[model samples]
Target: MTVATDTLQAVEAVFAERIEAATALGGSWALFDRDGVVASGGAGIASLDPARPAPGPDTLFRIASCTKSFTAAALLLLRDRGLLDLDATARSFVPEFVPEIPGDLEVDPTVRMLMTMSGGLPTDDPWADREESMTREEFSATLAAGIRCASVPGTGFEYSNLGYAVLGQIIERVSGVAFTDFVTHEFIEPLGLDMRFELSAEEAVPYATGHRRVEGNGWLALPFTGPGVFSAIGGLFASVTSLAAWGSWLAEASTGAERGPLSAASRREMQQLMRVAPKRHTPPALPGAPTPPSPVVYGYGFGLFVEFDDRFGAIVSHSGGYPGFSAHMRWHAASGLGVVAFENATYARVSQGAELALAIVLDAADRVAPVSPSPAPWPATLEASVALSGLVNDWSDVAASAVLATNVGLDVPYDERRATIEAAWAAVGGRTAASRTPVDAECDSPDHLVWFLPGATGRLRVEVRMTPLAEPLAQTFLVKVESPEPSVA
Candidate 1:
């Protein structure tokens, strides 16, 4: 078996140190595996009040645009329920999002465009954050006045809070329930998440005041804003504990290990790349860490964006920022490990800290000696080929040619293959029988099954490729034997 990373301790240490170096007011962090939470804790204060305790696992922080994924999922759940069409334009439901510019109408800006952030609306984080508490009337008025389009609806990547706000509006109109109510009931409740769009005192988590690092004035405390039109854009309030749970669930979804409320299929669909985020940059490698050299390009899904590394693979995640808080979460789909971090400092870029910590953790994981991954089920076609291998021992015109493609027989003429096998048998002094373990399912060849068998003296490698014909034939066949050095007479 492969060595377990047991990376919880290392991940936590790096996470805490990163937060300390970032000089944020205070922060919390957690690490998780696909099955469940691995480790969770927080450093720094949750509230400035002396009477209040330091931030703990349950302390609440505004998750900001991380809420977008929930909004996107909510939309998908609506689709799953047949309440809305992803291809339908926002005008069909809300009837208030007036598109100001008309272009070559190949694909209209539908719910899909909004979910993918490809609606051509200009990147409006600054404007959107402040409007988190906008009333429905105000939002309607703003949209009705006509929306600006930076490019044709489906042509470019522009992160727009307006698009999500419109989606929230559509959810409201179609479901006949407020966005917060419907979301809390349908999505949050099912996931067992203690997430909220509004923070209050009576709940388990005490509200951590957001602090702004002023140019010369030091830290200025900021209050949490409440529900409004754009609330769907960045209105989630949760703890690292809860966020870790969220990340863990999503990682499981990625591998179809766990499905709750949202089917594994739908969850996987939500994490798919819909648009490339051009502005994302390669996060600086962690200090003194052996990071795999991989290009970092931000690609958006429903509400998620993954940064794919060539050697390591996809890290699915999203970051959040509000006036007084910053948060981020990342999980490896296959590995099911992730990091979630939250800070009570405005624009502190906590996302980078989470990213750096994950890199360090993953680098550590890479050094681990890997246990052979479990194989997928052996296909029946491949099983038949293995059975055909029995006939190879007594090859004749009909026996070899029946299962073998004409080209395969030509490549290594029956005579050449027969001679190769006989030579190995001669070295062993007898034709030693071969035995094979179960076929490795991780074989990546789309049309071939490749495996090795432990023989009496050495090993035998078997490879069979499928042909393009009605009856399956071995397009290519290989049998290689590496005999141990001949025993001294």
Candidate 2:
């Protein structure tokens, strides 16, 4: 898909505007499609090093907890190889990970629990960020000593860095390779991502220094911490350019696109919403302010959050926060478009910036071409649609038996549907034609078909929804006139 030059400029303008609004010391951002970076840019300094380099598009910033998805991917790869069972007790892989429920209550959290952040571990960002360099021995010793729990294993969502650290151990024990080595060799290198948890000074020339900003003054620079044992959880340093590649791989793979280190199916599986995060009590968007981050009822997948917008579709994203670095990457499953942003300031809340940028990209794309839903995937759906299209003119046994959903008559009488559709057909040139909507296909499982027909006033819009039965049945059939009037009459 070719993005016009003007569209790219509009996206870049929105990105820069968000950055300036945030007043971040320095940052970089990029827009990505399923294939790779569509466009990338950076403003300000990457770091306060003596060289004082201006921000470069390829500059690396510690992705912090965003590394969990990489860790999740590594474990998923290992799971596919049958080296271990994800559903089995995590203690089976890391004996030190036995749940520390009170009164010797032994809760067996499965490896899956760790991946989904559902393990009984408490949230430990501040503590875990500093524990990046912990050795396998140190981790084992600490786990052996038992850990605190907020709830029972597999109970609910609680972001646990220690849980991911345990997963790193499982990867090491199962793959006979260090977690970093496993990810670097298996995912990073093969994906052509210039990514790492460790960087030598010479290689770090483009790295961003974490910052502590002081309002009305300046900011304090913090030295970057090299890779550590817990690096598996929140230790990656990546450029927006590199993350664009990663995000593109994930977005494309979701479409069952047959290219990537991991199978498209597995990558898509890793993105499924395994658990819904607890609802946050966030304030509503201010009347005139830039749209606040979409009110998120977050759902956790392998390492990322799956946010479903009633208007859009599934969005896969993760935010990283270390001492002085913050970052976020987000993508739409339907559009295969993504935004990646990184900041040097501590807890910079850059994720919101990425979110607002995403809203802008979505608006820009919609402006370019109003989106439409894809044709139904099930074979019967097309047959059903053809059969249902017959109803536009008049209802018949052939169309009803072949296409009508079981409840069509009970829900809305055929007389009403026929009149409504016939009027819409008359209003919209009195003829109907079915064609795909420009919108991206929804990456979901409900059988659906969307198309529009030209009309006199505006256009006649038709939608068909169905069940996934072998002989699928249309569940809901809608036909309406697209105009200021909201009613179907």
Candidate 3:
């Protein structure tokens, strides 16, 4: 699917505004679909001291917690190789994981719980962010000493960098390799991505210098953390283009067959809602104002976020924030359309910009043409719709029988059903050539269709569902006459 050029320009406008509003040293963004990154742009400068120019799509920036998704995927790959079990306790591999819990609790959290952020560990942000360089021995000793739990194992939602740190140890024990090496060898290399655990001085690539505002005075460049046990929690650096490509691959899992490094099924599992997060407060309704759109429901998956919106369906996303870097990647699952953005500023909240840009793209797409519920309707279903259209234009018992399933006549007698059809069609100006032709036809699935038939006084809305037999027939039909709006004098 392709976004319109005007929509792409609107996306660039959002990032331009975001750079200034978020006070980032540099920012880059890209629009992606199932195909790949279709449009990209950047604003501001990469570094203030060195005085570099604005980063393009290929510039690298620390994607903090976004690295958790990679960590999760690596574990899934190990599972696929029959080397691990998600249901097993973390202690199964890392015997050092003996965190303190309430007296009544009987078991440690499972691997899945940790992956879903429901492992009951406290929500540690900047605190854990500073622990990125903790040595393996130090992490093991910390775990053996029994850290406190915010909730009982497998009981609640609490973001835990420590829990993920344990996951890194599991990968190490199972794969007999460093956490970063496993991710690099399994995912990054297989996908041909240029992402790295740390920015290398040897490589000739443009790297953004992360910064933070100091007491409303000016931006301060922050030092980069080296990789260690907590690297699994968040360590990888990526570019807008490469990250957008990665987001596209994950979003397309539902559209096609599985690809290796990670199966499509497993990729989709990473995006599913594993634990429901707490709801955000909504403002009160106003008297004479339009109803607010449905509130978005947030949930955590395997290192990813699953959000539900009444207007846009399921959205999969994740945001990362470290001392001086912010990153976000979000995609509409239904359309396989998304946005990935990066900003070299602490807690910049670039997600707000990405969300707005995607909304603008989706709205423009609807105006262009109705978004199909799936790729395309089945050929036989399309043929059945044509036959039904002919039946509407001129009623025929044999033609109706051929087009519809046997249940159609049994549910409602032919005479009664025929009368309903004729009356509805006549209300829409008695089926002129234009009135008989279907318009704006779309499918909920390959076997179900909805369309509009225009008329002078009204329009007829038609809907049909096909049976699940080898040779499917329309098992259900609905016809409604929608009257035209009254003209103002």
Total residue pair clashes for candidate 2 = 6
TM-score for each of the candidates = 0.80, 0.80, 0.79
What are the Cα lDDT values of the candidates?
0.75, 0.76, 0.83
TM-score, prediction 2: 0.80
RMSD of each: 5.9, 5.6, 5.7
Model 1 CA deviation exceeding 4 Å by range:
1-6, 102-107, 201-204, 254-259, 292-298, 366-401, 404-442, 445-489
Q: RMSD in Å for candidate 2, one decimal? A: 5.6
Provide the global lDDT of candidate 2 against the true structure.
Answer: 0.76
Q: Over the stretch 77-192, how does candidate 1's per-residue lDDT look in tens digits?
A: 88999988999987888777767655644445788998899987788888889998899999888888877777788777888888999998988998899999888898788889
Q: Residue-wise lDDT of candidate 2 within 179-208, one digit each (tens)?
A: 888899999998888888787666635778
Best by lDDT: 3
TM-score: model 3 vs. ground truth: 0.79
Candidate 1 Cα deviation (angstroms), residue 75:
1.0
Over 4 Å off in model 3, which ranges? 1-6, 51-53, 99-103, 152-156, 200-204, 257-260, 279-295, 370-442, 447-489
